[model samples]
Target chain A: MSERRFPWEAVLAFIFGAALGLAYAWVLAPVQVIDSAPEALRAEFKDQYRAAIAASYAANGNLTRAQSRLALLNDADAYQSLSAQAQQLLAAGQTRESQQVAQLASALQGLAPTVAPSTPTVPIAATSTQAQDPNAAATSTPIETETPLPFYTATARPTHTLIPTPGKPFELGTQENVCDESIGEGLLQITVQLTSRRQLPGIELILSWSGGEEHFFTGLKPELGNGYADFNMTSGVFYTLRAAEGGAVVPALTAPVCPAANGGTFFGGIRIVLQRP
Target chain B: MKRWVWILPALVIGTALGLLYGWVVDPIEFTDLTPETLRADYRADYILMVAEAYQSEKDADLAARRLAIFGSDSPAEIAASALPFGRENGFSASEISALETLVAALRAWQPASGAAP
Candidate 1:
């Protein structure tokens, strides 16, 4: 009878072949990805994109485009995301970048584009001179009128500057305790507007309770109202809210107590309205 | 000897299958992409954004820093490349002007603290 032997050599060869195949697959020729959407960017790169958007918003005060650009990230809550990012930046000692982001957040919070008609897109293309940059003129591509992105028009529009470098100072117009159970965990809602009732954004405020002080801005939640901002409050904590450095001060503010649909009680909220005196 | 005859063919077949799977069946999906890989049109728009911000800030250094996110391109060259794309792609003339201004600033820019090598 012929002696049978294990095919160790053939097995070894197959193993070698598989190893070579995997190396070639994983390293030598990996696939190339291009034309990726902004949403697909890595976390750090997304933050970078957000920073540029914030800076552009600061430069032009075009909240609409800024919001649209931010929407590309598909953040669950753009305002909260921005505020959190600003806080992160501040913690990282990137003070100016933080402020830029915070300022944009505030202005965006206050704008009610749907109702205010504040940032209307008026084309500015006609204002441009025929002269182009020599370098750009030389290497121009074959021009095609492609409208880019969602809701973007081909023409450049004049910016409606919402937050002047230092906008008009505001004084407390009204501070009321809203004992409503529906506004979620009780809010310290603040509304800021011009004397003419135009919602004012970019107004800075400081909120302090016994052991902690936090600074926040208006227009961070424009859907609520442009020039509107709010913070959550704990049931028993007393707080003091002030605008700018020495502007109007509202003291001894706290979350109110309200009747719930069930036989239970819920925390209420504070509503503070600020306007130019 | 019979098994040995199949080893080279097996290796070749394995390599072909691996290449097909890697390049076609399941191409590597990127979860962490930098701005350098942005689509041509989107890249142009991002450059336009930098130009708009430059128009507002008028700080070439900041513009350069923002442009630096592209990883490889010089700020001026990056901004310059966008202008032609912007012009041909329906970016308003004023937007084109903004791109021009940014490119000029980047070209003339010198580091404030002498970090240039």
Candidate 2:
């Protein structure tokens, strides 16, 4: 019998090819993605930093805690960014939110003195200074009484102190009685009407339920005629609507039991009418 | 040993051929993608999606859980770090803005301990 020769040459060839191939693939011919650092990305980081500060403020309601959390970024850009956001909010007529954001921005500025303060359209610094002065009580009186709602009777309409514009105030006629009615199968549509049967416009209202509150301006839908708004409520859920600007509470309206209608609409709802007393 | 001398030639010839193929010929070009790079690309999108979900669902616990995929750090930290990484990786201005908005929303939504959802 002839002795079988070992195929060592083939084995060696295979190993050599594999090794070379792997080396070339891994070291020489491999594709690479060039990494880049963008200025916009830096801006984004700054934005996130501000957002984080705002969120911390919202959660803890502690300026110190939020400031401590902001210390991690160690970037002074937070001041400029947050100051800009506050300005934007103020321009949009969100006074309360703008003040809150401005406070956060001021906190960031305190943390980083190296950063120059950005100019705010609103008198943030002046307002803050006035707030801190013990003897400025007379000047601060208007701010303390700037409630969104004030009491009004049928014979006398409350002055609109919370109007965003300086000269234009809301012309609130009077409080009318709300009519309890159901429409569109089981859907509850709360229609705010005047004694003249015209739909009320530009009235801010708050709807409060078990665990949540929603604020909305009326007259959003022209077809709904300025006074029509709808809310989804569970049967037996008690909800209250209050005039955000006048502080008058609509009689507590409970979701009424309604026969099952098309599209799962709930019926037996109440209609609210605000009339002059 | 003499008969096996062919192995030397074979090895040299095969290695030369493989090197030629890999270097100048039809070489396999593998993309050098690391986990960090992948995360850099997807991080902004992920944060925005999480924020939208949080807005609709208002579930902070779930947002925290989903945001944990980036790391063990707080969602704010992860988002803060990701802003730079995402920008370096070519995230658009709108995308970055969206991410920023979401981070803020998430921070605002974080409930106190034992608070109701």
Say which candidate scores most in TM-score.
1
What is the docking quality class of candidate 1? acceptable
Residues forming the 10-long window of minimal summed lDDT in candidate 2 chain A = A127-136
* Chain B TM-scores across candidates: 0.73, 0.49
lDDT of 1 by residue, A1-277 (tens): 9676776665566667766766776787676767666767898888878888887666655566677678766677877777667766755766656767877665665632211111222334243212212122123421332323223233332442333324445677887777766677768899877677866554567889999998876656666765687898887999998875355778898888877889798888888888864
Question: What ranges in model 2 sit over 4 Å off?
Answer: A1-11, A15-277, B1-9, B12-39, B55-58, B85-94, B105-117
- Each model's Cα RMSD: 11.2, 19.4
Cα misplacement distance, residue A250 of candidate 1 (Å): 3.9
Worst 10 residues of 1 chain A by lDDT: A112-121
**lDDT tens digits, residues A43-158, model 2?**
44434434534543532233443453344334456555555655555446654444445556644433211111222211122212000111111233211222222111122212
